[model samples]
Target: MKMIRNVAVGISGGVDSAVTALLLKNKGFNVTGVFMKNWDIRDETGNCTVEKDYEDARWICDKLKIPLIQLDFVKEYWNEVFSDLLEKYQTGYTPNPDILCNKNIKFNKFFDVARNRFQADAIATGHYANTSFGPYLENFKENTNVHLLQAYDSNKDQTFFLNQIPQQTLRRCMFPLGNYLKNHVKTIAKEASLHKIAQKKESMGICFVGKREFQDFISEYIDDKPGEYVDLDSGLSIGKHNGIHKLTIGQRCRIGGCENAYYVFSKDQKTNTIIAVDSGIHPALYTDFLITQDVHWISEEPHELRHSGVLSCDFRFQHRNPLITCNVYKISDNRLFIRLSVPLRAITKGQYAVLYSGEECLGGSIISYPGPSFFALNQQNSIIETRCCDLIALTSGVQM
Candidate 1:
């Protein structure tokens, strides 16, 4: 064990963090709470969210009898995270803000601030994740390769959003909530006379969106670049769309004049077009392969991958999805081609493809594109347009 005495915890006014700070204090560690001010905008309630959250954070600190510090990173957040997010959305990429937030704000900036400014022996967060170094960083050594592991509570594991965090940062980080379930954390808070905190509604969706639809929130930044929704099989115009940024792959598109509900299959930036297919697990939505770029490795390249230039592992792009068998081939230093054991539905580009070996999160990268769709695979045997039109007609109850 590193014998960490002074620990700085990132408190977000949530039940998880409250329990985390409580656990650290009970363990006899010198604890300080840090309130990070990343976004300064007001919510739909006409009050800034951080303001309300900060008040709650203050309450937790007072109850725990720990000193609290406030750090502002509004500028750093804008330049490092939000600007890149906006750029990606405008460029037809469905970027995840949570991933970017962990990579830039929480891990990068917070790590530096806690270690350098506050002189924390170890930094802690309420994230539902674990590490090879254990909670107190007992197993960490000089240049030790730390593996980000899944939480005991699978439903609450946050490793997906944290895959992009730097290795050095993970080495010194502690997740007190990792070994416990979400409900248990709430119970702990309640037992500590924090009933109000335990029962508070969970913060949902993008933190900055603040009670607005994603479409409405994003529209304020990007100009309306008009586009059309085209039927991928029929090559017929389904309807006009105000902007491609309004939707992403697998979303049930709300375009009118189409009897059958449609879902996006692809967004063509150059043509300003959205390729779509009728809903109901449409064959066009499934793919057997994906191309990824800018891969990040937690413990450098794995032996199997580096020695043979390929490795077999489990892959999951979305956090909620279960892991699937896959073979990842190195295309270059930071690029990879992944072959899935089974065709999966809605493998979205711009989303991450996280690789795993059992419980350890190896790393991940942004998906560049996917291989031939199920619809494409069947094209050689049948007339794609006619079959697709028939399927649409059948689903929508239209006469064939």
Candidate 2:
């Protein structure tokens, strides 16, 4: 008799995860439901919905006839994810905590616990992404390995969040909902009589913070420091802001009595100023090049990037705008200089610039700073020096 594979599914008490568990159970595998409690802190109202989620998870596990394993990683999440997130915001850059959560908590911590404790062959999630074991076309010398791919449901594809996940961790993972559309998954849940799970509304906002306002939730951790709002074009003081930490690049600023809505162009942390522009189409809001640090390739660095020094990229998640074609120049072992074919708006610092080749997710890096267009910088005879520990300083009158 053949032995069945024992698979662990990360259940988040949602329809996606519940259906993922059900699918695996019917597929003849020994399935186990694991509920990861990464955040347990309550908001100002003294409410935390984790207990309700736990109950929902328990109900699903009972229906599926599978044992549910509960694991708490609140301390690890606070140290690894939340600390870095706060630091990024403090430095005047908006960071994506969802990507960090996937890399640090879900794929790393939870992955380790499931593999070591449960001795499971593979772990599965409700994420809308697919993985395949195949010989990489770029590196023909290596053996077949796991590679992350976009799901069939383009609208719901989550390869963006999973981009930073290591290839080794991906090898031991399964995405049961990868090939199915969101509606189809709901249809399956309805047919299975999991009506409550099917009708459960999807949670939004930050992963741990639930539906609370972002600024309000963040203010709890960091106190508001008032600052000046200045016009970037005229370099004139316009108004006052409660906190620079509450603002982000490209966000609209509502200066009282100004009919024209001004957008945030940049923030000067040293001077405690928020630079605003009259129009969203301001030249400072767009950039044709950017510098990135800590670049991570999914399998291996593409041969073209190393040799030809160019590749196609998608710098943001679910960006429906035309794809960005850019040239990749290596600044160092851990840094890259990307020159885009066209100017991209709101090229904010601290956001992940994810790269891709067709449908394959090639991973990404944190955008350190937006660089001047090669043409413009060359015309000005500018020289950029990396003097302040990975900080690029332009010498020819170009200021970010």
What local lDDT score does residue 249 receive in model 1, on the 0 to 100 scale?
Answer: 85
TM of each candidate vs. truth = 0.93, 0.88
TM-score leader: 1
Candidate 1 collision pairs? none
Error of 2 at 325 (Å): 2.4
Q: Per-residue lDDT for 168-272 in model 2, tens only? A: 678778888888999999999999989999999998868666677777878988898888889866788889887778888889986897768898988899988
- Extract clashing residue pairs from model 2: none
Cα error, residue 215 of model 2, in Å, equals 1.5
lDDT of each: 0.90, 0.81
Mind giving the per-residue lDDT tens digits that candidate 1 earns over 1-400? Answer: 4567899999999898899999999999999999999999776667788998999999999998999999999999999889988888878888888998899998989889999988998899999999988876767676678889999999999999998989989988999889998999998999999998999999999999988899988888888888889998799999988789888888888887789999999999999999999975998999989999999987778899899988999999998999999999999998999999998888877899999999998989999988689888888557877888899999999998
Q: Which candidate's lDDT is highest?
A: 1
Whole-structure CA lDDT of model 1 = 0.90
lDDT of 2: 0.81
